[model samples]
Structures are given as C-alpha cells and as structure tokens.
Target: MFTNYHEAIEWIHSRLAFGVKPGLERMKWLMNRLGNPEQSIKAVHVAGTNGKGSTIAFTRSVLQEAGYSVGTFTSPFILTFNERISVNGAPIEDEEWLSLVNEIKPFVDELDQTELGAATEFEIITACAFAYFAHVHQVDFVLLETGLGGRLDSTNIAVPILTAITSIGHDHMAILGDTLEQIAAEKAGIIKEGIPMITAVHQPEALAVIQNTAKEKNAECISLHDTCSFDEQQPTETGERFTLRTSKRQYPQLETGLIGTHQRQNASLAVLLIEWLEQEGYISVTEEQIYEGIRQAVWAGRFEKVKDHPPVYLDGAHNEEGIDRLIETVQAHFFSKKVHICFSALKDKPYKKMIQKLEAVSSSIHFVSFDFPRAESAEKLYVCSHLDAKSYDDDPRTVLEFIQKKSDDPSAVILVTGSLYFISDIRNRMIG
Candidate 1:
C-alpha cells in the first residue's frame, strides 16, 4: 500500500490525459482487469449542469439514515482529495486513501500498457471510489456523480438502480454541446434500459429531449416538479428554513445547513429520490432520519460561509445559472451591504455571461487566475467583466488581500466565487 497521501495523489495525477474519449471501452477494460469491483454494489448515478452535488449529498444522507452503509463519490473536491470518497458521510481517511490508491495502481498501470493509456484524473478517481466502496468499505449502496457531460463520462460505467439529472443549464458548452437541447441530450445519456430515471424541473426544450431519451431507452422517468414542491421562507442567522412537500410525504420545518433558495429545490429532489427508493424496496429510511439527514448534511464550497466578521461568503458559481443563484441569495440576504467579489473561471466556461451576472451584483470585482491550465487570465476576466476595477496579481492570496482592504465595512460581504478551482485554492489558504 502507498505510505503517504502525497505519493498516492501524485501517482494518480502522473497519468493525466485531457479531452473527451467517447465510449466506455477504456473504462470497461480497466474495471474488468481490476475484477469488476463496481458491479459488486448497487449505485445511484447523478448527472446535470447544476445541483448534482447537492442531490448526491441528499441521496447519500437518506440512504445513510435508512441504516445502510453508503459510499459517496463526487468530483472537484473543495478542500481535500479525501473529500471525493466518503463512506457513511465521512471522508475517507488519508491512510485509507493511500492504501486504496496503492491497491488500484497496478490495474491502472496495466490498462496503460495495453494502449488504453493511463486513466484521466477523473477516471482514476472514479475507479478508486468504486474499489473503495465495493472492496474496502463493502457499502450497501454507492452514490456516484458525473464529472462532466454524462454520455462519455468515466462514471457512466455503472448500471445504477436509479439515474437522476438535476437542473440542466448551459455550461461546458465546448466539450458537451453548444445549445441547451444538445447539452440536455448529452446529460440524459445516463438513462439505462429499464432503470428509473429521476429529474429535477428542467426547461421545456431540455425536458422534451430528456423525456424522449428516457422513452427511447425504456427507462421509467420521474419528474421532481410533478412529485415534489418546496416553500422557502426568509433566511435567518442560522440558515433558511424550508418546507418540503411531496405527493406522499411532507417535511415541515426542514432547515438545511446549506444556504440559498436553489437548495430548497435540491432538498425536495433528494426526498423524492429517497421515497422512490423506499417504494422499490432498495432501502427504507424513517421520517425522523430523513429530517436528521437534511439538518446535518453538509456540502462544502457551494454558498458556504467562511467568515462572519466583515462577512465572507464562498460559492463555486462557475456558470451563468450558478452565478444567478449566488446573486439572488446575496441580494436577498445582504442587499444593503456592498459586495466585494473575487472571481476566476475555466477557459471553457461562459466567462462573459458569468462576468455580466457578477457585474450586476458586485460593488467591486477582483480577478485571479488559478494554477490549472484551463484557468483564464486575470486580465481577460477583468476586461470581459467590464468593470473598471483595480487588478490584483494572479496569486489568490494577493487577491484576498485586495478584497480585505476594499471590504472595510463590517457589514459588507466579501464573496469569493466564479470557479470551483478558485474556491479550492482559497480553502487551501485558509486552512494553511
């Protein structure tokens, strides 16, 4: 087994490959060579442009509350790599992660030798999660979230009991597709034959595409809007208290640890999925456990409050829809306070539209570039945002300093947003 976290992560990162390699030939080969660990357990596959993580969080929590040992695998870790693999709602320990990586490295290497090439960063991570859940933790169920568009994503390997698509939006246009209908088609690829597919409320065009795809695949499709509704009241210092009402169940006074109105919809979808699972006899969780799970569950780096004094808010609003939600939440909660913003985004993102949204809410904007190859230059961001603001160095710390100086008002809120990578960087700095 690997001796340390650094070695394990480095070994995985050493085999990074870019771009889409459509078809599951490579993933199927790799998993088979590793004894097909993914098949040993049941899974719930989630895909979407937005809110997939939150849906996963809710699904996992509900299963865990049902007294089943659940394993959750999601991408783009906010603070630590260990966050990608969790069992029973706790991140896998560093020692366990290293050991798991060591166990899976040989199979990954063998795949490389046979001309499949080493798995992508996301592919390797997905493999690790499956092996950990199936072989190590021996989980009763595993919740998997797609890394990107689902049609060709590495995580699409599983034949899940239920497939879910959260709210669809226009992000990753270059890699997925340019139009909403095309993107919806790609996201809808997770619908396997006869598998019950659950979806959040989607645009008519997107919904039509998804419905057609599910019909073509012979998958039973469940729409969240048709099954569930929510009532979000004003936010308090503790957080937002919302009521989740489904056709068969009602969770009144449901308070989420997560912020924003969008989360209310996410929670409703989670409840609906759990209800569906229970009906199918896949799992059985009590109403009390459901309430507990919603109250205690936490998904970091999405509308998370990092500081109280001089109020700092961190959200990974990397796309137009996400930015809109961030703006709405900020306006509702901190409308009187001037907003100081720190922003960055991947080159492939709709940076121009994202910038426009931020410009509408931001009192001052500071741009910074992350170390990733996909990150856009700070100068480009500043120009595209069309804000006459002073530029800071590419360094995240330097940008944070600028925000600190500008946000002198105790009531003023400093919002660190625009990209998940940027939030990851800030999270690293804060902990260090």
Candidate 2:
C-alpha cells in the first residue's frame, strides 16, 4: 500500500522511539499483536560476540544448496537496510519491502501508541523479517542472528529448532555484561529447553557456563571440539583447504571463500550443526551440498580484500578478541609491510585495547569518524591509539582520498578496520 520505499523506511524510522530496550517483552507483545508470525517457521537461532554473521552465511548457503528455501536475517547492514533481510542470499527487493512495511505500519503504530511505547529499530526489523519469511516468502528455514546479546534480544521470539552460540568474547559490555562469564551467560540464554545447543570452542570459563546452562534447561550441549576437529592448512588467495573431522563423518578438501585462519573453526561449527540437524531429522543434507555450500559462501567485511595493488583490506573488528584475530590475519598474510591502518570504534567498545593492538601492527595509523552518534571522535581515537600517526581525518572521504594518493607504493597495505558502522560507511563509498 505504500507508494515508495523511502516513505516506508522513513515512517518506520519515525516510530523508533524506544531506542533499544534490552528485553523480550516488547517483541513478544508486538508479535502477539501481529498474529505471531515467527512461530510459523522453523528457525536456527545463532548468537555470539563475533563470527555469528559469517556462520549464518555458511549455514544459509548449505541449506540452500540442500534445496531448502532459506531466509537469513543479520544485523548492521554494510550497504542498505534491505541487506539485513535476505532470502537465498539476495537482499529483499525495495518495492516489496515497502509494501511489507506499509502492511505492518498500522499494527506497529498501535504498539507505539500503547503503554509499550514504540519498538526499537532492531525490534521493528526483526518483526519485519519474521513476517516476511513466515508469511510472505514462506521460507523452509530461517537463520536468525541476534543483533546484540542473545537472552533479551528481539529476535529470540521463535523457539528455534537448533540454537548456536558462535565464539563468545568481550563485546557490548555496557549492555550485556563486563566479564566473559557474564556475557557468555547472556549468549547462552538463547539455548531453549530440549533444543540442541551448538557452541563454538570457547575459553574454559565460558564453556562451563554454556554447558551448565544447557544442563539446567535439559538441552543437549555440543561443543566444537567434541563434534569436530580440523587439520591445519595454509591459506591461498583462492581459498583455504582443510580436512574437517566430525564425530561420525570426515570431510576432506573443504574450502571456504572467507579469509582468516579463524574461519576454519567457524566452517567446522556450521558443518557440525548441519550434522546435528540431520540427526534430529530437521532437514536432510548431503555431503555434496555441504561441499558446494562451503565453496560458494561469501561474507563481506571480515578480512575482505577490496583492492589488489597496494592491498586494501576491510574488516569489522571492533572488539578485543576480534582485533586479535585481525592482527593475526594481517601478520600471517601481509607480514612484509608495516600495515597502514585506518580505524574507528563505538564508544562502548574496549577502544584502548583495540588501539594498542593496531599500534603494534601498523607503521602509521589514520583515524576516521564513522558519522554515528556512538562513534568516538578522531582526536580521541588518536590519543587512545598511542600512535603518533602521520595524520587523522574526521571525514571518512578525506581518509580514503589520502589512501588513494599513497596507494602508489605496492609494499604499503591499507587496513580499514574497527566498528561495523565504519565498515558500512567505507563499503558504501567504495561501491557507490
């Protein structure tokens, strides 16, 4: 019923007054009002501090290869709002999204007018994705990624067939919790009773908390180490090849399009989850489908190479653990060059630790503001980074221009990293 996409998006944004209240009550109430569309479809709920998005991508690709109509919902879009919701890896069409928004506007408006106030941006988007997948597209399976923490996240409405916690770490401490144990407990909250809880390998403390939670809920706990292992292999520009060994099956010659050595573990976790799903009779999957999916899956902004000469790499490594991985990846791949870094992070992250890591890796650093309210200023970033960088730019465009001018040096590698919002801005500028 809406005339155009912009009008619909604007109307939805206008209704976002509640601004990210961390609880399931609002989502539950709104879903009840909208006929509880989330309950209509089977779901695989994924949560963690990091790697959840890439794991979701791998899972979706595998499911689609197995011939299921798959719906994937991820957060913090790199380019467009529609990128958050996808069916079979393609972003939702703008016109269709507009119509869908219009259809849901009256109910959403009523929720806003009530004592509940209004849904946050994430809540509205989660509702829209559920409605679209369960009601409109009628997908066979939905791969749901939690936006922030898992327990109180808006997307936790559905009782998923399988719940996955990809590697937990210290991110979103202000909202979730400060300690790894506390944050792991929040991520573990997504483990529903009687559902198989699949968790990536974690620190001992985090692992214990997740396992105890699974026990308390009478859910089956499957660890990455117990379920799967991998043979060490070197990565090539094309992809990395590794042999994945599951409890009952061994997959030889598995390849992933995503970079970074950490992704091998993520890919293994996805394969193991698929194995669990098959055992539970949730979906029948073939080895061929798994191989095909592994080969084709692509996730942006995680060590993604945007340019070849002068080698520009883009990553959304906002947290300490993620930054450690990013540092490792850079050292492994571009060891010869003293990395030229551009960085930014949100106010809530461990900015000091991240800056220290970058300082260790880079010869010179350029700080750029991402234009988000949560984004720290370039001057603040420079001070925190502990680097007497050659320059700093509040404007992202100016930073990019500086990089272009310096790009003539083939030995120089420009690494654009930090917050996902910063990654979104850089990606838009490059592709636009």
Candidate 3:
C-alpha cells in the first residue's frame, strides 16, 4: 500500500508505459475485482471529439444547482490531477486519493499477471473514479467523459442512464479513423440499448451515424437541432447570453459564464439532459435552479481569461474542429480588437491546419514548445505559418515575457491556445 500522495500518484502515472490500449477487457476485469463499482452509480456517458469537458461541466453545474451531488470523470486535468475525479466542481482530497489508490493497487498488480496484461494509466484512473464514486464519496450522478473514441474507451465500461455526444470531428485519426463518418461511428458506441441519447452534432453524415447506432440499440436519440434550438445569441462581457427554445418551453435570457456561441450549444445540451431527468422522474428541479446553474457554470480552459491588461485568454483548441470554434468565438467577441495568439500543440495533432485557421484571425502568433513528450517543436510550428507576424521560441518563459510586454497595449487581446496540456501549463504560470 502507498503511504503518501506523491508516491501513489507517481505509481498511477507510471502505468502510462502501457499507453492507450483501447479495449475494455482489462477495465472489466479490474472493475469486477473492485466489486463492479461502475454499476453502483447513475452514470452519464459523454463521448465526443471536442466539447465533452465543457458539456459535462455544464451538466454537472445544473445538477448541482438542482441540489444533487454530481461526480465527474474527465481527462487531461487543467490544474491538478485530482480534478479528474471531482465532485461538485471540487477535486477529491489527497487523503481520499491515497485511500482509493491503496485499495486498487493490489487489483492492478493481479491484473498485470493475467493474460489481459497491465491496466493502462487511463484504465486505472477510470477504475479509481468508479470505486471512489461508489464507495469513498458516493454522488447522485456520475458523468463519464470518454478519453478517446467511445467503443473501446475505458469509460465505456459504464452502462449510463443517459448518453451524450457533443460533436464529431477529425481527431485521433490513427486510432478512431480518418473520416468523419468513421469517427462518428466510434463515438456512437456509447449509445446503449433503450437508453435515451442526446447530441449537438448537426453534420448530416455524423448525425446519421449516431442516429443509426441509437436505432440499432433501441435507444431514442435526440439531436439538438431536432428538439432544442437557441437564437438571439450574443457574447456578454463576462460570458454568453442566449435564448433557448425547447420542444416544450422557451428559456429566454439563459446566461452562462463560459464564453462563445459554441458554449451556448453545450449549455443547451445540459438543459435538455436535466429536462429529460426531470420528465423521467429521476430528479426534480425548479426553473430558477436551472437558470441560476447556467449563469454560474464556468469551465477553466475554454476561452478562459487568466489575466487582465492585455487580456490573456487561454483556449484548448488543439484539433481542427476546436480551432474552427475558437476562430468563430474570436471573430464573434473580439472583432474590433487586435488578436495575438501564443500557441503550442501535440505533434500527433493536425497542427498545420489549426495553425492556418489561427493565422487568419491572429494579428501576431508566437509558437512555443512546452515540456510534454509529444509537444511539437516551436521551430516546426513556426515553419507551418505563412503569416508575416510569427515568431518561435523553444523556451516558454521567454515567450511568456514577450507576451506580457506585448499586452501593454490595451487593444491587444492575448490568446494562448493550441493544446490543453499547454494551456494547463500556461495557466499555472500566469495565475498560480
């Protein structure tokens, strides 16, 4: 058993050596040994290429306002590793993490000796979240965000009461597939038999894939476009304000602290999910609670402004779809201002295309490599840009200094984006 927090965390991270083994066989085996904790909670399985975390954040906040405890299991933590297994937006205590890791370590060792081989880092983390939610700190609802494609992702072990796919786009092409339809099929794997599914996907081909999977599973799928709609959307000084029209009701002046119109879509998904929960008799909430929750909800790295006086905004626009949304948000909110972008991304991502989209909107872009193993070189990222206002620095501190100096101009809107890992690092440097 581990005696301290750091040792336990190190051991957990060490399993990264196993990398991303996609099947759930090892997860099933581990969960079975752990008394099948995943079955003990009412889980909401969320899968998508982007916006999964934001959607889960919106849903969790609404449920919390409705007076239900919500547990969230998400990947690539923004600030702390403990945030991956959080309840009510607060991360689990280190003591709880230590206890959970201690309890699960033996099963991990035993699973390693089996033909199933060692559990990957993600599998172990997923198992820990299940056990913690079921035994250590049980909650009314648990939202499981898929780490990768849905079909074989470790989080798929849960049989969720509700399923949601936020969007389908090109990401992890090597594993999930290179085409939108193929990727959509993999994401649709979360739709279980007879379970009601919700999605914000509008792409005809992608929507068809999810709809077909839901039909095959005898699940009733609701697309945001088909049932719910939002309009009069406008960016607010603090966030976004939009009017949502549902099949049964119209919610005008629905506001969220999270920025962007894309966020309005994510917030609407949360609203619809809560409505379904209420209609199905699983939970009850007032209209005021729903309104207040939407207004109060905020996610960390999606167009989050960490500093003032030049306004350093951090967005995790690592993929092609994500970059497109970020561009839209920038154009929508900061159309009249000068937009300066500081960016970095994983080498495996489609950074070339992302850079092209960013270059279109950015007045100047600084490419800096961070401390991740798969992070792209600043020089290579610089080479991809055709814009005259581009610079690269291998050392991020040097770039940070330059950004701080450039922010002296009140009209300059500083944006630090590209990868979530890079955003997390920059956020810590700027705020913490």
Candidate 4:
C-alpha cells in the first residue's frame, strides 16, 4: 500500500509506460472489483475534440451557482494532476487522493495478472474518480470528460444522465481515425440508449453521425445549430457578450469570462444542458443562476491573460482548429498590438499547418520544445514556419526570457500557445 501522496502519485503515473489499450473490458473488470462505484453516481458524459473542458467548466459553474455540488473529471489537466478529479473546481485534498489510491492499488495489481492485463494510467485515474464520487463523497452531478475517443475511453464506464458533444474536429487521428466521419463515429459512441444528447457540432459529416447515433439509440438529440440563435454577439475585453435565444428561453446579454467566439458556443452548450436538466425535472436552477455562473466561469490556459502590464497571454491551441480559434481571439482582442508568439506542440500533431495559421497573425514567432515524450523539437517546429521573424530554442525558459525582453514595448502583446502540456509548464513558472 502506498503510504504517502508522493508515492501514490508516482505509482499512478508509473502506469503510463503500459500505454493506451482502447477497450472497456479492463475498465469493466476494475469497476466490478471496486463494487461498481460508477453505477452509484449521476454523471454527464462529455465527448469532443477541443471544447469539452470549456463546456464542462461552464456547466459545473452553473450547477454550483444553483447550489449543487458538482464533480468534474477531465484530462490533460492545465494545472495539477489532482485537478483531473475535482469537486466544484477545488482539487480533492491530498488525504482524499491517498485514500483513493490505497483503495484501488490492490485491484490495479490484481488486474495486472489477469487476461485483460494491467489497466492504463487513465483507467486507474478514472476508477479513482468514480470511487471518490460514489463511495467516498457524493455530489449532485459528475461531469465525465473522455480522455480520448469516447467509445473506448475509460470514462465511458459511467452511465450519465445527460451527454454532450462540444465539437468534432481533427484530433487524436491516429487512434480515432483520419476522416471527420470516422472521428465523429468514435465521439458519437458516448450516446446511450434513451439518454438525451446535446451537441454543438456544426460539420455536416460529424453532425450526421451524431444524429444517426442518437436516432439509433432512440434518444432525442438537441443540436445547438437548430436550438440556439445569437443576437448582438460581440467580443469583450475580458471575454464575450451576446443575446442567446434558445427554443425555450431568451438570455439577454449573456456574458462569459472565457475568451473567443468558440467559447460562446461552449457556454451555449452548458446553458442548453442545464436548461434541459431543469426542464426534465432533474434539477431546479433559475436563469439568473446560469447567467451568473457563466459570468464567473474561467478555464486556465485558454487565452488567459497572466499579466496586465505589457500584456502576456497563454492559450493551449495545440491543433489546427484550436489554432484557428486562437488566431481569431488574438485578432479580436489584440489586433492593434504587435503580437509575439511562443509556440510548442506534440510531435504527432500537424504543427506545420498550425504554425502556418499562427504565422498570419504573429509579429514574430519563437518555438521551444518542453520535456514530454511526444513533444516536437524546437528546431523542427521552427523549420515548419516560413516566417523570417522566427527563432528556436531547446529550453522554454530561454525562449520566455527572450519574449519578456521583447514585451517592453507598450504596444506589444506576448502570447504563449501550442501544446497544453507546454502551457502547463509555462503557467507554473509565470504564475506559480
């Protein structure tokens, strides 16, 4: 048994070497051994390529505003590992994490000897989250964000009361498939029989897949494209403001702390889900609660302004679609300022295409690779850029210092983008 948090965390992370095996058999066995803790909790299964975390943040904040304690399970945490399983935005205490790891470590060891083999790192973490929410401390609702493609993801073990697909895009293509249709099929796999779904997917191929899946499951799928109508939508200095009209209600001047136009779509998904919950008699939440919740919702590392003077922002736009959104956000907010970019990405991503997009908006681009197995090297990312005003560095700190020196101009704005892992590292150094 692990006696300390450090040992417990180390053991949990050690399972990473086993790599990802996409199947539910191991998760089913683990859950069964743990008394099926997932079955005891009311969950909302969320799947998508990019906006899942933002959607969950908006939803959780709204639920909390209505006086409900919400548990959220998300991946690739922007802050700490403990943020993966948090209650009302607070990471579970160290003592709670230790207890959870102790309770599940035996099953993890036992599973290693079985036909299904040892569970992956994500599976163990998913189990810990389920056990904590169900057996240790219950909450009004648990939001489960799939770590990868939905169908085979470990978080799929939970039978959620509601499900949402934030958006379908090209991400995790190696495991999920290359085409939008194939990716959509994997994402739509979260749709359960008779469980209503909500989505913000606009792509025809992707939307069709989700619609067909919902129809096959005999579930009503609510598409934001069909249900939501925006009026007077405009970007704000801090975030955004818009009048959102859904089939059921009209929210005047809805505001959010999250940046970009895509965030508006994300916030809309949360509003729709919360409205659906209230309409279905599962929860009671006033409209005011939702508005306040949205206004208060903030997800770190998504165009987050860490410093005011000589403004410096961080955005985790690792993929092409994410980079597009990041570009739009930068254009919308800092069009007048000279934008200097610090970028890094995973080796497997289409950094060439993403860097191409960022090049259009950047005054100068600096590339630096961080310490991750899959991370692309600074030289490789730098070579991908066609910009004459670009530089490369092996150490991110050196690149950061160089960018800080350039940020002396009052008209210059510094942006750190690309991989979330890289952003997490930079955020700790800059803020913590």
Q: Could you say which candidate leads in lDDT? A: 4
| 1-432: candidate 1 lDDT, tens digit per residue | 567889898877766654456667788987887789878879989999989998788777767766888888888888777888988878899988888788778877777777666567777788888888878888888888998899898888897999999988878787888888999999999899999898994698898899999999999888888767667566755456877788888788887768887877787788888888889887778999888887676788888888776677788998999998888888777888888888888887888888888888888888889899789888888778677764645777876686568555775788889889889888778654
> Residue 123 lDDT in model 2?
86
Writing each residue's lDDT as its tens digit, candidate 3 over 335-421 gives 999999999989999899999999889999999999988999999999999999888997887657867787669789999998899
User: What tens digits encode model 4's per-residue C-alpha lDDT throughout 194-298?
Assistant: 999999999998999999999999999999998889999889988999999999999999999898889999999999999999998889998899999999998
Model 3: what TM-score?
0.99
Cα-lDDT of candidate 2: 0.85
Measured by C-alpha RMSD in angstroms, how accurate is candidate 4?
Answer: 0.8
C-alpha RMSD of candidate 1: 2.0
Model 2 lDDT tens row, 1-432:
569999889877775565779888878987887789988989999999889988988888898899988888998888788989999989999987887888777777788777877778788888898889877898888899998888899988887999999998888788888888999999999999998899994699999999999999999999997667788676767556889988879888799888887788788888988888889787899999999998788888888888777678889998999998888878777788868988888887888888888788898888888678789988788877666765777899976785786678878988899998899899888865
TM-score of candidate 1 on Cα atoms, chains taken together: 0.94
Give, for candidate 4, the lowest lDDT window spanning 10 residues: 399-408
Candidate 2 deviant stretches above 4 angstroms: 15-17
TM-score against truth, every candidate: 0.94, 0.96, 0.99, 0.99
Off by over 4 Å in 4: none
lDDT of each: 0.82, 0.85, 0.91, 0.92
Candidate 1 CA-lDDT value: 0.82
Summing lDDT over every window of 10 consecutive residues in candidate 3, give the lowest-scoring window: 398-407
